[model samples]
Target: MKKIFVLDTNVLLQDPNAIYAFEDNEVVIPAIVLEEIDNKKRNADELGRNARQISRMMDGLRNQGRLFEGIDLPNGGRLKVELNHRSFAKLQETFAEGTNDNRILAVALNYHMEEQENPNPRPVVMVSKDTLVRIKADVLGLTAQDYLTDRIVNMPDMYMGYLTIHAHPSVIDEFYTYRYLNVNSLHLAYPLNPHEFVILKDEMGTSKSALLKVNADGKKLEPLFLSNDPIWGIGARNAQQRMALELLLNDEIPIVTLTGKAGTGKTLLTLAAGLLKVEDERKYKKLLIARPVVPMGKDIGYLPGEKEEKLRPWMQPIYDNLEYLFDTKKAGDIEKILAGLGSIQVEALTYIRGRSIPGQFIIIDEAQNLSKHEVKTIVSRVGEGSKIVLLGDPEQIDHPYLDASSNGLTYVVERFKAQNISGHITLERGERSHLAQLAADLL
Candidate 1:
């Protein structure tokens, strides 16, 4: 049976194309949702951009028929602009107020009642990105669901970029002696992606092993390009870090994703490789570092300073890594070194839009906070000869609308796993210190 889905303001703001996502199902837009979108349309951010796009889409749909009376959608579904379902009698007892959220819920409840009156009643569901709204809908006995179209992968089964294969002692010895192994020599459970890391262990109970990467042809496993050498004096402390370094330093792969919790060396390793490529090797003209501005708790708005000064607090983590890479022991020494080099540029992700970035090594830190569309915009801005690295902990997302599965970092990692130009590594070990690792594990 066809169902009626009531959308929340946040769903449309997260993706303007969400109205078309429900195939052959009635999509209802609460009048309050339009008002909310209008209120946010004037801001200069991704939210405003989505609001404006939704407004344009609604305006274009007006020619089909009256939205209040309902019109046929391109996907053979009904698109409606519900204006008169604002009565909150059903929720007044539970919610006690007619807020926008309550009003949206009222629309769903009203539709549900209307459906019940029919001989063959259809389902009335509320689709929202807000968890509290969904919980309230459940309390009110209404069906609520999250927008799952943007979710790419779940955390428990997320891609880890490397897999271990138990092989015969002779195969391990051949890999060690030859420094490469043919793809057909291994018994594989699944297809390997380009640049995917692999660990060949001796099955004869010996301790012999070799680390290899899927070559560009996907037909052989070649030894990692750099294992003993340190990038900017920061060596890989673990197997996952070594895999991450291989992806970061490789010119064949243009996009690399590094995911882990705090103290996993995601930022430090990325910065080290970026500096090596841009400064030491001169492969790129500049090392451009950018990250989303989402705060851990309180925002930086209360601080009094200019834009760069204001960003210093958020970008300080990047600077700390750079200081360590540059061996700047004293305070202000890193700044002096950066001023002299002029090869590294640090900025927020806000200014990166509407600009084409090329011939640079780009590092986007805290990328888990970005939406799918935001990630698309950033990746699309990468012109030829530019390599972009996205680093974040999927479990440590800060965006209200984004979670571990639906955020852009996970999205890219899942979507680009099959592409030859992309590589991904999930760092499993926390190398900061024993205490830090214990805190990450227990707390």
Candidate 2:
């Protein structure tokens, strides 16, 4: 049986193309959702962009027929703008508020009631990205679900970019002697992806092990390009970080993703590799660092200054890492170093849109705050001869509509894991400090 889907404002804001995702199922857009989208259509952010895009889509649909009655979608689904279900009569007793959420719930509840009156009723699902909305829907005895089109389902067991295999003791020795081993020699149960990291352990249970990477051909295991060499004075402290560096420094792999908790050295390692490639090796003409400007807690509101000064707080973390890499002795020293280098640019992700970036090493910090579309827009802006590294902890996202499973960082990690030009590593250990590591684990 065909179902009916009621979309909340956030679902459309997170993904403008969600209207077409229901797949021949009737999609209902409450009138309140249009109002909310209109309110957000003018502001300059991802939400505003999505709101405008959705408006344009609705406009295009409007030309075909009256939305209030119902319009046939290209995918054989029916789209309708519901304007009559705004009354809170059904929810006044329990909800007791005329808020937008309650209004949306009212619309879904009305559809549910109408379906019940029919001899054969279709399932009514309220799709939203908000947890409270889903809970309230359940309280109202309405079926609800998350917008899962872009969500990575098995997030807990998602790809970690590496695997451990126990082989014959001689396999480890052979890898060391030959410097490379064919995939068939491992007698593996699963196929290894290109550039996937491997830890070959001794089957006899000795302390012998070797770290290797699947070559681009995905047919051989090869030793790391930089075993112990430090990049820009920063060395990998763990096996995962070592694997990350292997991908970060490789020119053939143009996209690298690093994910970890608060202090797993994701940003530090990425910055180190970017600096080396842009400065020491001169492989790239510039080092461009950008990150979404999502606030962590209560926002500090606006500050008074020019663009650079206004962006100082948001870019301070990047500066701190650069300060460490440059070993700046005093305040403002890193800024001077950046100025003298003349090849490094640090800006918000906002300014990066619509520009074709080439011959640069780009590092997108806190990438987990970005939505799938936002990340796609930024990455698609990469021109030839450019490499983009996205680094963030999926669990530490700050975007209101994004979660660990749906955020762009995890999304890219899963989508690009099998591609030859992309590589990913999830750092498990925190190397910031003993206290930081303990705090990350315990609290």
Candidate 3:
């Protein structure tokens, strides 16, 4: 039987195409959700972008037929804009406020009670991204669910970019001598993705092992591309770090995704490799770094200054890594060096769209805050001879609509795992400090 789904504002803001995602199910938009979307459409962020998209989508739907009275969707689903719902009876007392969430809950309650009285009632499920709204729905005896069409992977089974395998003692010795071995000889648990790292251990119980990368052909495992030498005065201190550096320094792989916890050197290693490719090798004309400006909690509004000054706080982490790479001892030294070089650009991700960037090494840090559409926009901006590296700790997502599994970083990793032009590595050990590592693991 067909079911009815009442959407909250957040679900539409998180994914504008969500109205079509339920597939043949009745998707009802509360009148309050439209009000919220109108209020958010003028803002200047991803949420606002989505809100405007939703507004345009709804307007297009209105062109077809009256929205208040249900309209037929392309996928055989029915879409309706519910405007008759109002807070009634226990709703006002239970919620204690006429907030938009409560108003949306009232719509769900109205539908739910109507269904309860029907001899053969269709299920009414309130779909929202808000945890509190879902909880309140349960209290109101209404079914609620998270809009989960964006989640591509579960937390436990997320691709880690690498796995360990035990090989015969001879295979290990052969890998050490030959610097490469047939992938079939190791007998991995599953087929390794192109560019995925493998730690080949001795089957006979020896401590000796070799860190190998699956060749782009996926036929053989070879030694890391650049492991022994330091790049921009920084070298890999752990096995996973070595794997990350290999992917970062490889120009053949145009895109790389790095995932890990805090203090795992994901940003540091990517910066080091970018500097190497841009400065030492002169492979690219510039080193461009950008990150999404998603605030954790309360936004600090606009600051007074130029673009660089306005970006100082949000880009401080990038500066910290750059200053360390340059070994700047005094204040403003890094800025002076960057000004002298005139080859490095650190800009916010906001200004990256509608521009084609080429012959540069682009590093997008904190990519977990980005959505799939945002990530696609950034990747599509890459032009000829440019390589883009997306670095993020999936577990540290700050975007309200995204999570560890649903964010763009993980999406890129999963989608590009099979492509030869892309590579990924998940750094495990934290090299920041002993205390930092402890905190990352324990806290």
Candidate 4:
């Protein structure tokens, strides 16, 4: 049976195309959702962009028919602007204030009530990205669900970019001698993705092992190019970090992704590789680093400063890593170093929207806060001869509508795993410090 889906304001804000995602089911848009979208349409962030997109879509739909009565959608669904369900009589006692959320709830409640009275009743569901709104919907006996069309993978099933395989002792020996082994030698059930790392262990449970990566052809496993060498005075502390360095330093790979807990050296390693590529090798003309400006905890309101000063707080982590790499001893030494170098640039992700960047090594820190659309916009800005590295911990997402499974970092990792130009590594160990590692695991 076809069901009726009532959308909340956040659902549309999170994904502008969500109206067409319900298939042939009837989609009800409470009039208050329009008001909320209008309020956000003038802002400068991603939310405003999405709001304007949704407004244009609704305006185009108005040409088809009267939206209040119900208009036929291209997907065989019926789109309706619910005008009569604005009454908050049903929620007045339970919810005193008739806020936008409560008003949206009232629309779904009225639909549920009308469905109960009709003999041919359709199921009513409230779709939202807000947890509390979902809870309130459940309290009112209305089914609620998250907008899950953009989710790429669950946390447990997320790709780790590498796997350990038990092989005959001879296989390990052969790999060590030849420095490359064909993937068919494994006789595994699944094919290894391009650039996927492999740890070939002795089947007899010995300590002998070989670390290799699947070549771009997806046929052979080759040894790492830089196993023990340090980049910009920083070396890989673990096997996964070694794999990450191998991908990061490779000029052939134009895109790389690194994910891990708080201190697994994702940003440090990326910056090290970027600095080496731009400074030592002169392979790229500049090093451009950016990260989304999502604040954690309660926001501190507007910051005071010039453009560079305003972005310094958000980009302080990048400067910290650069300080360690540059061995800056004084307070403003890193700033002096950056000024002298003139090849490194750090900015917010907002300024990277419409520019074409070429001959650059780009690093996107804290990429887990970006949505899929935002990531696409940033990636599409990459011109020829540029490499972009996206680093983040999916478990540490702060975007209101994004989670581990739905954020853009994981999405890009999964989508580009098969391509030869991209590589990914999920760092498993924390190398910041013993205390930091313990806190990450326990606290």
Candidate 5:
């Protein structure tokens, strides 16, 4: 049976196309929902963009029929603004001001009670992204649910950028003797993304381990067993760091996303690989890096100095990576190399809004702070033959509207995992220092 769903303001703010996503089911928009959308329509963040999108969608639907009563949707569902709800009971007794939330709850209550009075009652469900709203619905004896259209993964299944694989009985023998194995030797499950990491164990599922990368067909691609120690200089303190280098070094996979705790080598490895590709290999034309300049919990006011000094705090990490890559002898020598390269440019993501970048290596750090709309804007700016790497940990996100699962990093992982042009990895190791990894794990 077709059910009726009452949408909350947070639902629309979280995802603009949520209304149409509940296809073939009747979707009800509370009268108070419009007031909430109107209040958020002026802001510049993700919520404001979604509110504006919902407004435009509603306006376009006016051509079909009356929204106040009801209108037929393209996907075979009906939408209308609830008019029979007055919220006198919920407001006079529970809340004093008849807030939009209380008004929405009142609509759900009215619908549920109406269904109860019918001979063949259809289910009335209230959908929201607010935990408080769901709790309030429970208090009022109503069924509530989370609007989950935008979540890329649950907490457990989110890409940590690495995974351990127990090798077969002869896998270790093959790696030790041959130093490399064909893609068919490893019997991995189907549908593995290109450049994803895997650990080859000693058949016993423990002992004498080796890290490898998967080709497009889930084959053992990288077997960097060059008779010795790991890449100590680049800092693979954890197994995931070893995995990160496998992705960073491979040129076949154009796109990669690295998410990890603080002090991880996410920025360092990407910048290092980018330098190798542009300067040494001449594989790409330029090395471009950009990030949102959102300050730590506040705005960065004007700084009275040169451009480098003005952007010091926001771009400090990027500068540090350049300094390391150049092996600068003097204090200000890194900047000289940057000027000499001429191909390396650090611009704000805002400036990339209108330009088309091709045949370059682009890295967007602190990407977890971006909204779905903002990330879309940045990714669409990529032209032909360019590799755009998005690196950021959603756990360290600073955006108010984004969480671990709702941010653009996870969104991209969920949306593009199946495509051939994109690839992703979640760096689990903190290669900064022993203390850094300890703090990330225990503290």
Candidate 6:
């Protein structure tokens, strides 16, 4: 049966080509959605770019006929700008003054109810990016769905890029004794992502032991060099950890991005790699680490004391990682290291703008908090002979305008992965305490 898809403004803002995504399904653009798009089109960001793209698409369609009325889309569905629907009557009982969401709902309700009365009726599905709007659709008894095309992956299943395998007891022995196993031979359930972790279980025994990682190939993976352990003194806990270490240790791929849950070692690996490159390989002259001060916005509110003092809290985790790396036993040991090393600098991302960095090993933590535009700006600042790593999990992102799929970190990974100079790995499994892993999974 033919179906009608009513798109929300946010869906278009998130991805302008959303209209073409419905394939053969009829597309109904609520009149209010245009107004919302018009309001956001002037902004200078990804959303604005998408809005303009949508405008251009609508313009291109204008040649076929008036898009405001009805036009045939390339996907074999009719594109329409809905101006009237009888469902507005239902809104009168629920909302005295109609809000935009209510109006969009009214359009879907009108269509659904009218179709129900039709001898031959079609399905009407409301497509939106807002969770609340979808919830309201259920209350109104209309079908609702997220515009899933913009998502980086299909589901939470993308967490570690997933791979499961069973190995003879020998693989576990190789993992503990060799501390690394061949990349092949494990025969992962899923194709191995460069830094993807795997849990190798004893296929036969219920009480059999587990091997955290045995590498993707049957080659001896790099051992955890004591020098490369996170400042916290912990190493990669599983196969994914070793994979992450391999990617981090290699100097050829100048840009690497790591995305994983907290304790999956995203930050730890980046820091460890940066330290290894700077202190051991001399691949770069300095190791510079920085993170966005803003969790959601660019705002850094005024704080007491000096600039560094105000930044201390935002940079605390970075310091903690550094402290662990240095094995600072005394209370002030880390501060002293920071004073002497001078090679390592922890600062806010705000200061990074307009600075041309060269011959440095740079690690940008919490990169998911950065906007696509902001990321472009930061990456462009790199001069020749520099390696910059951007690390963060999209699911754990705090950026208001970006989701896991569209955030700067994911954006960078997708955009750069094809290039020989760049690589990406999504870490799975938490090396943190079992409780932390449980929280990541359930909560």
- TM-scores for all candidates? 0.93, 0.93, 0.94, 0.95, 0.83, 0.74
- List the lowest-lDDT window of 10 residues for candidate 5: 224-233
Clash totals in order? 0, 0, 0, 0, 2, 14
TM-score of structure candidate 2:
0.93
lDDT of 2 by residue, 77-175 (tens): 999999977457978777988899999999999899889999999999999999999999999999999998967746778899999999999999999
Candidate 3 segments exceeding 4 Å error: 295-301
Please write out the lDDT profile of model 6 over residues 1-443, one tens digit for every residue.
89999998898877777888988888999988888888878864456677888888888888998776799887788899887665577867866568888898889889888899999989999999888989988888899998877666544544443255667878777777767776665654434444334566677775555434223342333343433354335576766666667667767667878888887878877887788778777888898898987642344556788888888889999988788778889887898887887888887888887799999998999998876667898999987899888888788876555677767777687666445566566777887689998999999
Give the runs in model 4 whose Cα sits over 4 Å from its true position. 295-302
For model 5, the stretches where C-alpha displacement exceeds 4 angstroms are 42-48, 119-121, 160-162, 182-184, 188-191, 216-222, 225-233, 279-282, 294-313, 320-342, 418-422
Error of 2 at 361 (Å): 1.9
Candidate 1: regions farther than 4 A off:
295-303
Better of 1 and 2 by TM-score: 1
Clashing pairs in 3: none
Model 5 TM-score, all chains together: 0.83
What TM-score does model 3 achieve against the real structure?
0.94
> Cα lDDT for residue 195, model 3?
93
In angstroms, give how far residue 152 of model 5 lies from its true place.
2.2
lDDT of the structure predicted as candidate 1: 0.89
Compared with the true structure, all predictions reach lDDT values of 0.89, 0.90, 0.88, 0.90, 0.77, 0.75
Candidate 3 Cα deviation (angstroms), residue 211 = 1.7
Instruction: List model 5 lDDT by residue over 414-433, tens digit each.
Output: 78766655667777666678
Question: lDDT per residue, candidate 4, 1-443, as tens digits?
Answer: 99999999998988898889999999999999999999989876778888999999999999999999999988899999998674689887688887889999999998999899999999999999899999999999999998888779878888889999999999999998898999999999999999999998889988999899999999999999876888888998889999999999999999999999999999999998998889999999999999888832223246786778877888899999999999999999999989999999998887777999999999999999988888998999999999999999998988887889988999999999999999999998899999999999998
Q: Decide which is better by lDDT, 4 or 5.
A: 4
